[model samples]
Target: MDIILTSLINLIVFVLGAAIGSFLNVVIYRIPAGLSLLYPPSRCPHCLTRLSPFENFPVFGWLWLRGRCKHCQAPISIRYPLVEAATGLLFLVVLWNTANPVEMIGYWALLSWLVALAFIDLDTLTLPNSLTQSGLVVGLGFQIARGWDNGLNPATVSHALMGGIIGAVLGLWLLDIIAFVGSIALGQTAMGAGDSKLAALMGAWLGWKYLLLAGFIACFLGAFVGGGAIALGWLQRRQPMPFGPFLALAAGLTALWGETILNAYFNLFFPTW
Candidate 1:
């Protein structure tokens, strides 16, 4: 009975996540284009036909429509459904990783932002300040609330504020330094300001130590993927790729398993300790 109940709950959570992801798609498409997210509602870009309620039902809706607009028969991008499904799976993973309700809600919000930022960067090579700044505020606020709930000690409040602020500032500083150096070497912009803001937001949530780990992971993955693409003739050696996706991926991993990964690294190299 417990197993069955747990399965049912998981299913419900995944559906909830998918519904949220459907909204994220609107944000991803509209925000970069300077459109109001809530005004016009979801519509077919090709035909400007407003999507019907049944036709806007997240993953299943796309599948049911055969990935095309009913009114104009224009093919819809598969990315919409893909984003929805990925968000659903991501939520389930977060559910498995933590039992704390507060943590789960926080992580859910973080991942949602990450997903939207990643796709937006991929499309436009820019991360919106609105999302990044809002994320930072939310993260720090969450830390303060959680700390206060634990106790009313001054030390506790100071630690929470310091952790969030220092982590965010450190992330921004390090990225800016890297960008400056890389720009000098390349004679072009190496990283966008948006990337730094994204990192700062990440740091606010993960703290300074985990933020460092996330940065390392982002760099490593970015290098590997970028190199592979260049080698395969998909990109030129000098081509600029958006770094936001890699950063988002790294942040998500760190948020979920930074401690486990760090411990494993130390354990492997310093087993005697």
Candidate 2:
């Protein structure tokens, strides 16, 4: 009975995540175009036909429609359903890992932001300030609220605020410095302010220690994936690639397993400690 109940709850959470992901698809499409998220009801981009409720259902809707619009028969991007499915799975993983309700909420929000930012950056090579800036504020606010939930003591409150601030500064300065040095080396803009903002958001959520881990992980992923793409002739040697996706992936991993990874590193290198 307990196992059944747990399974049922997980299913419900996955469905909820899929629904939110559907909305995120809307945000990804509209935000970069400077459209109001609420004003325009979701419509087929090709035909501008407003979708029926059944047609708007998450992953099932794409399957039902056979990956094409009902009215115009225009093919829909598989990414829509893919995003929904990925979000559902991610929600399950996060749910399994986080026991506290508040922490779960924070993790969900962080992942959601990362997903949207990742896709947007991939599509446009620009990360919207609206998402990153708002995310930074939300992260700080979340930490402060978490501190309050734990206790109203000054130590807790100060620590929460200090940690968040330090994390944000660390992320911002680190990225800014990298961008500065890279620009001098390459004689072109190597990174954007948007990337810095996204890093700051990561720091605000994960704290400085985890943020450093995330940065290292992102650098490693960027090199590995970027090199693979170049070797495959999919990307040019000089082509500028978006780094937000790697950063988002690293932040997500750090949020989920930073402590484990940190301990493993110490165990491997400083076993006595």
Candidate 3:
């Protein structure tokens, strides 16, 4: 019975994640256009035909439509289905990782938000203040709620969360500072304020120390991909690429495997773990 119930719950969570992914697609498209996500219903960019409810059922809908608009038969981006699948899969992973009900909700919400943030950053090279700021606040709330849920000391929880917030902001600032100096040396702006905010927001959830792990991973990814792009002549040495997606990706990965990696690091160097 427990196994069946768990499977059912996981199915429901995955569906919910898909639903959120659909909404995220809308947010990603509309938010950067300075449009209200709720006001303007989703439409095909090719024909401007409104997508019917059944036609908008996330991944299955995309499959059913064969990746084309039902009204105009215009091709839809394959990225839509991929994003939906990724979000659903990640949701299931988080559900399996989380034992607490509240933590499950919090973690899923955080992942969904990150999905939207990442795509928006990828497409538009901008992270809307709405998503990043809300994620930060919600993450901090989750931290406090976790402390209360576990019956931990209020003072300790407060101090720790504060420390996380401070650490993330300072960490982001440090990255920006490095970028500023690099720009002076390299002759182009390499980082932006949006990435700084995203990093600070990540700090809210992972706190300062693990936020370092996220930053490190983001930097590595940036270096690897940027180097490849440069080598391919797809990008100039001074051209800017979006950093928010890398930061979001790093934060999501760190949220999952950060402690394990951090402990391994400590074991290797400090013998503390």
C-alpha lDDT of all candidate models, in order: 0.93, 0.93, 0.83
User: Which residue ranges in model 1 land beyond 4 Å of their true spot?
Assistant: 152-154
Cα error, residue 17 of model 3, in Å, equals 0.8
Model 1 — which ten-residue stretch has the worst lDDT?
141-150
The number of the candidate with the highest TM-score is: 2
- Please give, for residues 104-155, the per-residue lDDT of candidate 3 as tens digits: 8877877888889889888888888888888888888877777667766888
TM-score, candidate 1, is: 0.96
For TM-score, candidate 2 versus 3, the one ahead is 2
Local error of candidate 1 at residue 82 (angstroms): 0.4
* Model 3: pairs clashing at backbone N, Cα or C within 3 Å: none
Which candidate, 1 or 3, has the higher lDDT? Answer: 1
Rank ordering of all candidates by TM-score, starting from the highest: 2, 1, 3
Error of 1 at 77 (Å): 0.8
- How many residue pairs of model 1 clash at the backbone? 0
